[model samples]
Target: MYVAVKGGEKAIDSAHDWMAEERRGDPDVAELSVPQIREQLSLAVNRVMAEGSLYDPDLAALAIKQARGDMIEAIFLIRAYRTTLPRFGASLPVETTEMACDRRISATFKDVPGGQVLGPTFDYTHRLLDFALEAEGLEAPEREAGEAAHPRMPRVTEFLNQEGLIQTEPRPDVDTAPRDLTREPLELPAGRPLRLQALSRGDEGFVLSMAYSTQRGYAKNHPFVGELRIGTVPVEVEIPELGFAVEVGEVVLTECETVNQFTGSKLEPAQFTRGYGLVFGQSERKAISMALVDRALRWKELGEDDKGAPAQDEEFVLYHCDNIQATGFLEHIKLPHYVDFQSELELVRRLRRETEGRVQQEAAE
Candidate 1:
């Protein structure tokens, strides 16, 4: 007698065991410590925090290791971890003006109140791979000696304000309703707050590609980064008992401002147009891209002519984003669908009969 296929549960159990072993790698080699991953794989950790909307380096590292260096999987892990955690409460909006900046720069101005501080950037480094790193090279260069610290960093926007260049964004009062993307389904024509939230957790690669498209004449958006900043913002929570805002914790943020030159309309004279981007972590490229996209989407709000650009379309920008959402919808098509297959079969059978009849008539002729 023929034996039927077996080990459904057992096979799954064994596969999981094998996966765990594979993730850890060779038993002979020393296992990677969580702290080591956190310190060394900082960029991966940053990506996880940025995409996952969670900020725990150690956990991010663990997720990275488990994911076998897949940044998306690491993000998924962080997202899953975050979902399980209990929410204490929402903190008051961060005071970005009070941020103790680590790196502050502006492309718009040569001389601002706070001088440009280029801190810890790989932008200038050569793209060549070092052979020494093949064997886990030691004796890396130490941190560069910091020059004199600037007292206060006045925002590059402040200089624009002095010149009355761009429109001033109104600070939200406590009574202002925040449109929550998590609770409510995303609606068309997103406001700045909702758009910013989507962008912060968006796939870095996707945003980069879309931003690149804008530069390559797909959308004629000439964007120059007005300002890019990496710093910590103080997170305050209003203590009901104390009746005041108290500093609970802090988070690293990347803020970007893009200034686009706009020739004016009949009502107003020529003015320097603007875009704003703010995100978690120190992603300058992503932040800058977000700013440019933000400006493009604000065409209607600013009363500028809708050039029908992809970036200018509110529905296009808000809907076709977020890697997690994109990936899920895309991969879902791969799942089992016998019902669809039966429908396809019916269509194919009808087509085959029609084709045969046509072939027989042609043969007779």
Candidate 2:
């Protein structure tokens, strides 16, 4: 007998074979190397790294190449690969104040201690396409270099904190270990640390949409960008043998702090609240969005009323933010459902025949 499942297996294999050929594109065109993608299309690689919950630029670039530039697919590839890797000991929290600043800006303050370092950004660029990029071997325009030394820049919040204008971030009396959602299942009524971890690796579009809803008065808390900084921060880990921490390496990070609305009662004076975001690359927009969403999700903790907004719902936001989960559920409908569909078809036909017989009998009477 010709089995349907066996035939489907062969068909799937053939499809993958054809897909491999199609990914290569024109034979005359030069093949793109992993290094080229990592260096040139770094932003895409950054998104993959962020959403994939992994930090290997080379692997991200390779996944992008294999997925034919489909970012979600690349993220899926990276996430799948991550499952096979061995787990290492966790690193200590990186200090952003000591970051080698690439870009730093503040909307609330006119000027900050480190001053505004614009760095490389598309914010001020004209939207017109530059045809110069189409030309082969076009040299990039050069500019004067700045100071080589990386100075310690004080965080903008530190200024507000000095005067006690902003509420300080909560810390446990004892140094409790933060929850890891990757290792453990997500439990509802999660803490800020767990929520932030989910948001850091969540889908950019989903997080951005949730943030946008808050701005559009869904859960309006009147947020202002306190500060946004992007740079490479030194990563360290505690060495048990040495009985101290040692610098392992460095990673590029984007940190955002949003000053939010104040809420106080008879017991405490009103102070400016804060929402924080930290991500794996030069993802300023994502960082800002994450901050806004983070604030919205803190309605209960901040002693504010539950506005019933989608962003304010912890269960909804955390459950739906993962693109892998969303895509898997959404895409599964396209798979074969012959047995289920056949049952439905039989039920419908049987009902139709019974109705037709009843109608004929009524007409005869």
Candidate 3:
């Protein structure tokens, strides 16, 4: 005999209480401060900000701590918080050309106008673990006197244009504002720039794996990272009161552009195809992967035939993304569904009995 399921409200309330208690952990143990998490678990914070599209590191850190260091959960927390924030106004598009860079490098040219600066990276580091980190003691590096950074950061693509190695990417009118995805539903067949925004806030592992498959010859996308830059860019919002743009705050970003080779067609000559990436904070991998996928999605725009590949499908990519949406739907399956299941059982039993009777009559004949 099946019992009618009930107490869903009570169950939900108890579950929420339990979650709160779990997040608190042992009261006797030291509680984690947001600042501590922000400083200590920087990488996790960065991942959340990159995927969540929220630049607040403290919130990201709190999410990570509450999630018990689960990166995706932390991302979800940030995304939830992101949704609650009221939109004040749109900021003027950040000028990467005016970015105060900490790290900038290009692969397309031996030397570039920007002058490659490998400011901070683990690329050349040995794989062996540094045992010094095991000890609690550490010394800060000394600051040198009479040291000054470059007055201006230059675009690496400038050098390529000088030699005519690549076509200069067209810059649209800065006045033409972009539609906010959070405010409106995302329509299909978006431009590369819009697609990048969606994918940047997309599932990190999902996007990365898709890009990896393309690299493994699942699709015909060969990418060379033309430039990878990590830096702080000013966010300027035009305030009517101020009557000019003002810097509200600055956010760290990792920007990458991948150069994909293209063949000539009737309309255009062979030019270096482009894929772009931009993400909050130091997320080189995410940024680079995003660029590759961006290019793969642009196959049709560039006059390349659709090879029926996963990357070529815009709906498949955008609709399946967003960890917040994915998690909510997946977790909802655990909720009680007695009404739906009862209907299914009745339909199935009637169908089975009818089929059996029909088979017996046929056998008699």
Candidate 4:
């Protein structure tokens, strides 16, 4: 009795055409260029790159444009495109110590090796809209000419490390292979590396909410920002034939180190634990949130009581963190469900008839 609607291909093509037209609104006005989006709307591009797990600024910009500035949709686009690329050699772990830091700060220490360089942050900015920017003749802020180069900044965690106050990360072993989430299905009891990978690419808003829950006494693991640094690090790939690592490219990264308090267990002495967050670009809030969530997830390993918070649940957090998966499932509700709806309708009707018959029999008795 049900007739399937045809011309789906034509409808889809027409929809795409309409979308394209909407994307390029007002032909008379100059079109927004990809380069302009890449530079001017850098933060949005950074988020897309971070969540998309791709580093190309131009491609991220393109994705952003295609998605009509919807960052999650842009990330989905980038992720889809990333799957088509052929796999080359994997890059060696980037050396953050050698990072030419643009912005560095620490909540734990007053004065670190490199003075706190509050570079290009909106933290102190007044929320008031700049109406001047709407019209022409906007002047750029004057820069101090020939400013001194920033001092080589050491990590704030290093100070804690010297006194053995914080837990040390395991030394990198060449033989140890990291579990790639893309290649393998995520299993329970995930290691630090796997969890970090998931957090790095997880939805910003979702991660932020989870992190916020912890602050509101859901699973309060007292956290302090040991170091928050944003900089560019060299990416290197090991050449098998050449037998050495070579610089492939450089990528801007935002790294956060959260030092958390841990009461001494029976076996080990009380030492500060660490939660780390590293993302593709200058996303400080996301990076900080990620650090908090990362530390929360480590509760099981640290032998602390799990308060059964959503953030503390590894399975819950990891499973629902991906926007692509969440969006697809949510959007699928629009698909044809006539058979499903008919079954439900029939069951309800049968239930109502049976209830009426029972009521009549009871009245007669």
- Report each candidate's C-alpha RMSD, comma-separated, in the order given: 2.8, 1.9, 3.0, 1.9
- Report the C-alpha lDDT of model 2 over 59-124, residue by residue, as the tens digit: 999999999999999999999999898987989878788899888889999887878888879999
> In terms of TM-score, which candidate is strongest?
4
TM-score between model 2 and native: 0.94
lDDT of 4: 0.90
- Candidate 4, residue 124: the lDDT equals 96
TM-score of each: 0.90, 0.94, 0.89, 0.95
Ten-residue segment with the worst summed lDDT in candidate 2?
143-152
* Better-scoring candidate (lDDT), 1 or 4: 4
Q: Candidate 4: minimum summed lDDT over ten consecutive residues — where? A: 1-10
Q: Deviation in angstroms for 9 in model 2?
A: 3.0
- lDDT (Cα, 0-100) at 36 in candidate 3: 87
Model 2 segments more than 4 A misplaced: 1-3, 172-174, 351-365
Candidate 3: tens digits of C-alpha lDDT, residues 238-285: 989979999999988899988888884677688777888888888888
After aligning candidate 2 to the native by TM-score, how far in Å is the CA of 226 from where it should be?
A: 0.6
Residue-level lDDT for 361 in candidate 1: 100
lDDT of 1 by residue, 1-365 (tens): 12323555567689999999898899899998889888887777887888888877788889988888888878888887887899878887776777778888887788877788787788788988988787864887776566535356877877777787776777776798777675577886677888877777788887776677778765566887887888888888888999999987788888888888777777756778888888777788788878877777777766677777787777777777677778778888897687999999999999999999999999999
On lDDT, the stronger of 1 and 2 is 2
